[model samples]
Target: MMDKNQSKRFIQFAAECQSSALYEHLSLHIAEDPELLELSSYAQKGQPMPNLIFGAVHYLLLNGKEHSLKNFYPSLVNQPETEGVFTYFKDFCLAHREEIIPILERKLVQTNEVRRCAYLYPSFCYIYDKVKKPLALIEIGTSSGLQLLWDQFSYSYGTGITYGNPRGRVHITSEIKGDSTPLLLDTAPPVSVRIGVDLHVNDVSNPEDKQWLQALIWPEHHERRELFARASQCVQETPIQLIEGDGVALLSQLSDQISTDSLICVFHTHVANQIPKEAKKRLTETIQEIGSTRDIVHLYNNMNDGDLHLDYVHNGKTYNHTIGATEGRGRWFEWNIVD
Candidate 1:
């Protein structure tokens, strides 16, 4: 549990990293406003409080809530007001206190950043190259399962060449920092299966779910919002199996369903931070248990550290390596994985 000061610091950091002037200003004001900070405490345990509070407010604004605050959000207005946003923000929360509390308590901070597939694209290529088998993808904490369709999307890492599905509806662009280049296939690898497990799965087809997911995007990030809309469309067109449950608990059961012929690749991005330490331990142990029986790859980060990691068990031997460091939104990545 984070104290109010700690929460303030976290929000400050988020504001700095997100490049959202709206959120940055609001976060600074929220840090000093005891009432708003207290209200934020209603968010579900383990959820990022700043994001939840902001999303709840954004949800209300997007869902036809009449308020002056709407004028300050870039998502809502063409020319958003720069000054006195905190006043409107505070006023909106107080006016809709009851409505906001339920949302904060219920909603999880699940932003299905589709551009993250930039790294997943190359990671899958590496897996296919090594095992010479189609990959069976099992994604933990999949909000809408948009990322489960990584192979269905196209990607470009600032190169002249395009990768993955050339005809993909969702085209993701990212920057590759550093000299090391990841093994990127011209076309996506064959996927034998796609399964996503989450405590709550947001069905992209559902209007309310779709709205909530959209609201999770920050007020100023037009690009993220656009990407989200495109990815949501892609997800609806090509659906994957989504299970509603504790992903860590369901790992063993899910892996059993995948064919042995396909290389099982269990992965999650930007999700481990929300997982409890004990659950993360259980997840690791379960993966190791599964690895003992057959080959399995686990690609994840924010469990023990922020760096992206690729861990696997091949021929009864276990291997672990930090593949790269990624921008939280997949804007850029430092690929350390070498040939």
Candidate 2:
């Protein structure tokens, strides 16, 4: 009855999601099983998004649902259209409500993608050229402080364009979309100071938090999954300090700690869109206040979309440009230079 009474908006969302990006297995299974609508009766607000669905799946997989994951999951079996998918899926959902309910209650869809450092390279290089010094960097909404270390990874975006740490643990490659390829930095400038600010921070060392981080990744994306493993390993060798607080509240204070000699850069990818209008306003004001005192570059983009843009202030002048676009997980990049 819970599945029968549960709202179908999530199912509809699943259908649309499959069309846009390639998360067909999770989306399709959910769409086909309207019985899952019964989950609404247990509603943490009467609905669950794909994130909640996958969260439950991951929790079970990481714990004790090996047979369910192995036999039924599309990512594992390679077939969402296979018969009995919705049947087994429904059984799992219904049977595991005890576990799924609390997960649905938490509503955590937070994902920290490390490969996006591939998208940030060109922007960092541009800022380095302007300031000609190492960067003092701070990140907002840094779930695990992973992407905060983008410069530490190597990238091969287009055929001839290669950059970043070649010896780096994680290697990211993206396709070129248009004629205007982005400027490549043979070597990324050094990042001397790095800090992360978030309402809740994930400790990479913690096993439960790490599994949750992995759960946020779409199932079919093994490359991204592997890359995340590498980056996490990289972090163990060099950890960035994470400041637990609201991003805007911490921005000014962190910016103050940066030395005048090194370039100051505040950046976030796929983090801004989740913020409400009022919070975004505060972030904008905080950046502007910092800009008034000195030059700083803000590298940013929204969730799901690959485009990376630059907003920076130099000598009291503000400028904006679309630096490039890449796969959501930074698989490839079509660097767009705005002249």
Candidate no. 2 TM-score:
0.87
Q: Name the best candidate (by lDDT).
A: 1
Alpha carbon lDDT at 332, candidate 1: 91
TM-score of each: 0.96, 0.87
Evaluate model 2: give its lDDT. 0.71
Candidate lDDT (C-alpha), each:
0.88, 0.71
Best of the candidates, TM-score: 1
Off by over 4 Å in 1: 1-3, 6-11
lDDT of 2 by residue, 1-339 (tens): 234223355556566555324345445555555556445334455234666666666667656575553455434556634445555666777777787877777646668777677667777887787768788888888888888788888888657656888788788776666447566788778899888888778887998888888876766667767888998888778858888888887788788888888777888877777777787788788888888988888788772244777888888999887766556666566666755
For candidate 1, the TM-score is 0.96
lDDT of 1 by residue, 52-135 (tens): 888999999899999988998999999988989889999999999999999998888889998898888887788788888889
